[model samples]
Target: MMQQSTIIIILLSLFFLTGCWDEQLLKDVALINSQAIDYDSENDTVKLTIALVSGNSNEKVPTNTTIVSAEGKSIRDGRTELDKKVGSELFASKNQVTMFSRKLAEKDIYAALDGNYRSPLSALTARLAVIEGEAEPILHAETENKPLISDYLRDLLISAEDTGAIPSVNLQNTLTTLYDDGQDIVMPRLKTVEQKAGAKLIGTALFSDRRMTGELNSEESIILLLLANSKKGAHRMTRKVQTDEVDPLYDYVTVDVENMKRKLRVKKNELGNFEVQIDLVLKMNANEYPGDDLYKRHVIKRLNTQLSEELTKEANIVLTKIKEANCDYLAIGRQVNAFYYSDWQNIKWKDVYPTIEMKANVDVEIIYHGIIN
Candidate 1:
């Protein structure tokens, strides 16, 4: 009798575990791959768009792709409006990219992103980008060739980060930087171009106070990436140095940077003013060093001097650009907070950030010359 009771209890437990109460089959659900948010300034409404992947596990090729959009006074409201068309609850757990329209970014995106931040299903790791034009076009363009636009954007962002063109900023990091008192934020700026090849990532957006303050060109964006310590892969540095009597007047040297370390020091001057000093240690391998003489002290010194000068010049240009844009990408305010907490409290970071004197010293070490000496 006890054995029979045990078997019956086991059968009942198995029956209770057999059903997935809140789970839907793959066929019954639409997989959301990417999302776009746009602001209609004239209509004073927020537009939310989602891209749904149309493919089955057994199918070798995707049948089609679909983009659905809805507009309302807020992001949540816009999502509710989208329910009218989707007919099912939206799921963002698989979302890979989130594109914000320029208009929406220009007006403070905090209110628009409240829904994403509050939602339990939303992904904090989703890649964020600022769309140059309309967000819907990016979601809709080349849908036939690219089954899912979100996956494409994700790959593009990963490539961009590897190439050091833009710093990788996910939803969580962006929000943290924006909310932190000692730092500002930046996002990859993406634009679709009319080219025979196809669309591509163009630039990056600079943000100040949770708004789109300006944009950085490709080169400037790379420099910003380096300054922000976001560079992960190899970055090439080209410098022209005046040669001696044996070589040409100028020889171009291409350096493959392997590693870079940056240290920031903030201190108060005797006059009570603040000064910031940046020290960078870089390790590099020479890709193209045309000089016949190798391991010469003068040659190394000359190369070091030229590299230092060029790097300082580039760093100053980037700093000036960010200052003009009114975006503090370097997080100079963090230094202030670390060294002079009391003074930072008395002074407004934005007001005094532009006036702070900065000095940069870069030291580059040539570790190798490829396979050669």
Candidate 2:
């Protein structure tokens, strides 16, 4: 009789644990993949757009997605509008990317993203970008071979990072830098091109204190990332060095950045202003430098000198742009505060950055050629 009672109790326990009591069915919720936010200047409101998977996973095949937009006084308000319109539970745990319009980014994206990061279940690691114009259009842009706007843009950001064209940025790290006094931030710049025929990743957007300041092209961006010592993967460059004016092909040289060593120092000058000194040595492999004798030491020396001068000129131009925009992508202010606490407390970083004198030098060393060399 005791054994029979024990078996009956075990059967009852198994029955209670058969299924999850609070499992959310896919058919009852709309899964959000990507989102865009724009500043409605005319109405003084915020516009929010969301691309979500249709809420019919069990009912039918969900090949099509529902792209919708709503406007309200604030981001959360707009989110509420979307949820009411969709008429289903809005789930965004799988969100891939968040795009901020140029206007919103320029004004200040720190406030615009508050709704996204406030939730503990938010996709904090979602990649974000500053659209060159209204971010909505990119979502609707025509793509013959691409999957969707969000997927294409996410892949583009990954490609840029792989080539060392932009620093990897996500919603979490951005918030940290946005609040930091010493470090500014940078983001991927995306734009629609040719009457919305396609979208392109033009370069990187420079930010100062969470506001977009300026931009740098793909080539210039790689150099900037290298200077920051944030190489994502393989870094490659194709430059038309001053090799031969007659042979246009010979003017082009391809190289791979194998390694780099950067040093930054901050010192108070005699004029009582901060001057930063940056020195970088880049080791490169000569990939395509034809029409020259690779076996001869003298020829290699000339190539090295030419490349060094050219890269130095480009690096200085980049530094000038950074100063003009007052974008501290290098985190120089952080270095100062960590090492010179008293000096950091006295000087306002925003004011000092624009006028701060910096001496930047880049030297290119071609340590290896192909096997023939």
Candidate 3:
């Protein structure tokens, strides 16, 4: 009888602790999905805008979002104002992306990212990008079938990154590169489309230290990715080639990069001349060939040779831009630190980078033509 009475007492105690004592309800929490920060340079103020999914759990898919904005002298102050603007308590743990206006990115990227680091529940893995104009406008942009702006932006970035059109940069990656001495950071650029009533990924913004130095167009961005030997899923490129007896300067052919191998080395020649050599080998598929006679051995050989030359030329152009920006995204500085410690210690890398002898040797093999060929 004593044991039974004790068991009943324990069961009754468990029932009282079943529900959360300090739990916050979903309906009373505003989950931030994305945020955009714009800076007023003259006043040294920040305009922070956030997009939050409407806490409407009744529907199968939440189709609406809320936009709230606040301005203050600092990011933390802005957050306080943001709390007053929203109906429910603000939560940032669900943030999917973060954006900065071009002016803000150029002014101080590290400052813009400070809040991300300080917040314990901040979205550390959120995608980061720079907007061409004001950052707030992106929150209100139309997102067709994709109801939420955050979902649209996330998918857009993931798609471009997978195809090697832009570099994959997130909060953690950006912070890592920004802090690393030997490397720089690159972020995708976003701009509003006036006619389409939406936004699109434009190019990529290159950063030196805490400021954006330059931008690379879509084609150049792809070339940069290629030079970095980024792992991509079915990378594709369209190049112009001279057709047989064609009067036009070139005809376009689209090729799918089936397989790629690259080797980079920094070494001193017999004459003690330092050089950086890049050896690239690509197995490609002629996905779309406008030229005639695809099966001809001479034509295949000519195409292969032209492709290799064009890639080499493109690599040179990219290197020139990289040198001009003086942003070391190629990990060349890291290589020097590892292999040429004496030289690295003796000479400043920024001064020697532009003068360094860099060469690209490209070899392309056309593994398959289209099924029609």
Candidate No. with top lDDT: 3
Question: Scored by CA lDDT, what does every candidate get?
Answer: 0.78, 0.82, 0.85
Q: What would the TM-score be for candidate 2 when compared with the true structure?
A: 0.90
Candidate 3 on 1-373: residue-level lDDT in tens? Answer: 9999999999999877767666878778889999999998889899999998874568877888888999999888898899988878888889998999999998889998888787887888799999998898988888687889989888888899888788888887788788876788889999978854678888888877788888888788887887789868666889888755654434877888888899999887887656888888989989887665778989889999999999899888887787777778887888888887987888877677767778887899998898875
Model 1 per-residue lDDT tens digits across residues 1-373 = 9999999999889866766667766656666788889888898998899988776678786656678999999988987898889956678877898889898888896786777788777788899889887877787666345455676779889887886777888877777787877778888888876642234777788878788888887766766676777657676667777656766634778787788898877888898887877777788777787773547777777787788778878777777767776787788888788878889889988888777777767788777776655
Each candidate structure's TM-score, on Cα atoms with residue i matched to residue i, is 0.85, 0.90, 0.90
Give me candidate 1's TM-score against the actual structure: 0.85
Comparing 1 with 2 on lDDT, the higher-scoring candidate is 2
Off by over 4 Å in 3: 1-23, 55-57, 243-250, 268-274
TM-score of 3: 0.90
lDDT of 3 at 231: 66
What's the best-to-worst order under lDDT?
A: 3, 2, 1
lDDT (C-alpha) at residue 26 in model 1: 60
Candidate 2 Cα deviation (angstroms), residue 167: 0.8
